[model samples]
Target: MQRIVLFLLTNLAIMLVLSVTLSILMSVFGIDRQGLGGLLMLAFVFGFGGAFISLLMSKWMAKRSVGAYVIEQPQNNTEKWLLDTVKRYSDKAGIGMPEVALYQSPDMNAFATGANKNNALVAVSTGLLENMSQTEAEAVIGHEISHVANGDMVTLTLVQGVMNTFVIFLARLIAGVIDNATRGNNNQGGGLGGIAYFAVVFVLEMILGVLASIVVAWFSRKREFRADIGALEKLKHSQESQLEGSMMAFGINNKSKFISLFASHPPLDVRIKALRDSQ
Candidate 1:
């Protein structure tokens, strides 16, 4: 519940900031009052539009960038078993059967993505398959499935799209205002004016972006807790092993490769602790 609240609040704040900043920017650009609604609609189109497009293209992006091999229908006995396991979990989670794929990454990681629950993909790294025990692998897969079941990827994309619009709005607005203030001036303004204005806006946006990222990261950490809970609940019906150890095992095994910024998931210590305390 705390995680859900944090997720909603953070996204709300991002949307609010983006809307207000865009309105301010539009005003500074001398946009007609009558066209404000249209402009806002355009903003929404660009924001949500971009996000949904990216979501749609996620499979292609992953395949291209990471060289993911989609195991289409998993034909052989071993492949069939893997597919069956995924199917079982998807059924247990009450979500559609997600397409399972493999990617060759040295890092022991797995991620799930799609625009919606029915249309989803789950990809596991070679390291994850090779290193983790069967129980541990199932637990980690549970965590990734939880991410899909919880619709986290879509939510994050929405939040990010809103942030993007705000960044664009603020940077342009600040630039326009400063440019206007410096207009009709010679050495006092013109030559250095545009550059100076841009510099200030850039700095301010960067600062805001950094702070926003921290907030986003905090929200992300909360969601990890919820996903852990989901994993535990799934395990109750499906398996007998403790979910807490799975995260610890993952961390202990791959601590060297886990980079915080690139990793949307929280640290394993935090996840393990949260699961233990919750149980």
Candidate 2:
């Protein structure tokens, strides 16, 4: 929960900073957000700028928020086994060994995050280590390692940038129109007070942002399925069984489309079916 909140706050802060900065820079260059080209350019910068910054800072923020500590020296069999397994899988995946860490969490969860495929951080919850069998943990680590090798972080950043672009563009476009209409002007003029205009844009951004999040999450789910396949390939042989026993539902995917839009991963049953169908 803390991790999720911190990650979101970081992204939001970046978005806010970039949005304001882009507006100022564009204004200095005589670029009007009302103009189609200017609007697109502003959107592009804000969208991609915020996303890339978030990517660059992902590992740092994840470590702090999750209270994860990298295993510099294995103190016991569990830590040693964890470190060795991660190395083995990362080697097989053709990526550099990621920093393996553990966070004190009760949930059986783990994640892989980094800006580069060759350099990454893979962290698992304490509960996962305490409860899962060796094969299950191996499957879990392979899944995360595959995420690093597949460069899902960068891919997700691109997807987010595109989504953010649309969100920014559509919000500003509609808000500009409304502002003009309210002022009884044909041109894109701010009839609303300065505060009101900004407020409108803010509201529009929030609304469109939710829609954009759904789209991004849909893309993420697809990406997750791909990582699952990557894990299957790298772990071959008993990969299907490995995943079946290891993969757990990370979100409420069966609720509805709207709910599923916010899911971190597809349901375990769906994933299992996907695995079988693939082979």
Candidate 3:
């Protein structure tokens, strides 16, 4: 729940900042606000721009948020094994070697994030290493590698860009109409009617953003299944059963319906069934 709130609030801040910046630029340039073309241009500028910026900053943010320490010089056997395992998988997956790291988390979770496939960071939790057997831990690593190999982060960013474009475009378009109706020919801005317009746009953006996330989450679930399949294939002929069981265990133990609608991965049961069915 804290993560969800943080993510939402961060996105809200980005959108608000970009909107205000663009508004200022438009005023300076004397851009006409009477056309769909101008609105769309502005939307794309801020929408895709913000998505790409976030993508580029993802690795740095992940490290800070989780206190992930990259294994520059492996100090222990486990760190050595982690670096070796990731290198082996990256070779098979046909991607450049990714920086491997460990974070201090009690939860059995891991993630991969970067701007591109060749440049990525894969990090796992301390809990995952201590709790899971060697085979299970390797499977988890393979899953994260698959995410990088499949370019899931880049694709997700593009999808978000498109969604952001539409959300901004629609919110402002509706807000303009409301403003015009309320003012009814008054050209002055910053009146009570202008305040109403701003309030309406803010509320509408939040509502539309929520709706857009459903689509993003749907795509995310599909990718999770694909990544599972990729992991199985990558680890084929080696501890297949252990990998499957480990993934299922991780999912089942961490199941929650509260954020299902906004979850990046599908429910554990669904993922387990998909893995079993695929075999």
Tell me how candidate 1 scores on lDDT.
0.60
Error of 1 at 125 (Å): 1.3
Models 1 onward score TM values of 0.67, 0.82, 0.84
Better of 2 and 3 by TM-score: 3
Residues 71-91, candidate 3, lDDT per residue (tens digit)? 999999999999999999999
For model 1, how does the per-residue alpha-carbon lDDT over 57-91 read when each residue is reduced to its tens digit? 77566555556788987767656766777888889
Instruction: Show model 1 residue runs off by greater than 4 Å.
Output: 1-41, 73-77, 184-214, 226-262
Clashes of each: 0, 0, 0
Q: CA lDDT, every prediction?
A: 0.60, 0.70, 0.73
lDDT of 2 at 15: 53
- Against the true structure, whose TM-score is highest? 3
lDDT of 2: 0.70
Off by over 4 Å in 2: 1-15, 185-190, 226-259
